[model samples]
Target: MPFPIKVCAVCSEEFELKPDKPGFANRCPECSIPESTGDSSTKQRMDADERKNASEANAARRQAMRELLYRKDS
Candidate 1:
């Protein structure tokens, strides 16, 4: 295997090359990526919730408007 003679910036580990992971060793072979948190489930859930809440709010507003338009101001 071709390896570069480099050292990790974060862990300070020795490797064949400086990893593309910013500060990790290229030889670490995982968890070397600085931005790779791996999972985004919470973010996805929050996004879904935001969309759902907006949709619900819109629906509620439309319903209120419809009620007002037909409501005989009693």
Candidate 2:
């Protein structure tokens, strides 16, 4: 039997689907390869670290302002 035609989600190209294969792909072969090359976990971790650093900096700035306002001029 001939394979049925399916459209790729990423490239919007049509491809033949293999019925015998266990894993079926939503995107065509060309578009799917690039998607897997990047490490998502590393990217997420970097983003989280950046946010944490920004929060700490803001807190330190506010503390300095409070100390300046409370100090008595000699």
Candidate 3:
């Protein structure tokens, strides 16, 4: 019995289902030409959102660390 797999819509790369693999991505995780697939703006927005989330999280962590160090000195 062959485990069913399909070509990625983003990069047309074939992939098989492997539950053991990390993330278990069914498609190519790195598709450089997002614009050619007719979703450049969406991809860009997604990228921006991810960057913003990461930046916000990092800022929060830094603030927490600053507070902790300040309290230790008090």
Candidate 3: deviation at residue 70, Å? Answer: 0.7
lDDT of 2 by residue, 1-74 (tens): 88778898877999887655333477666665654556676564548888999899999999999989998888
Q: Which stretches of candidate 2 lie over 4 Å from their true place?
A: 19-24, 34-41, 44-74
Ranking by lDDT: 2, 3, 1
lDDT for residue 13 in candidate 2, whole number 0-100 = 97
Whole-model Cα lDDT per candidate? Answer: 0.66, 0.75, 0.66
Measured with C-alpha atoms, the lDDT of residue 11 in candidate 3 is 73
**Better structure of 1 and 3 per lDDT:** 3
Overall local distance difference test of candidate 3: 0.66
The TM-score values for the models, in the order shown, are 0.35, 0.39, 0.35
Residue-by-residue lDDT tens digits, candidate 3, 12-71: 898765555444365654543243565455554548889899999999999999998787
Instruction: Return the clash pairs for model 2, or none.
Output: none
* Candidates 2 and 3 compared by TM-score, better number: 2
Query: Between the candidate structures 1 and 3, which one is better when assessed by TM-score?
Result: 1
Deviation (Å) of 73 in candidate 3:
7.1
Q: Can you tell me which runs of candidate 1 are displaced by over 4 Å? A: 1-46
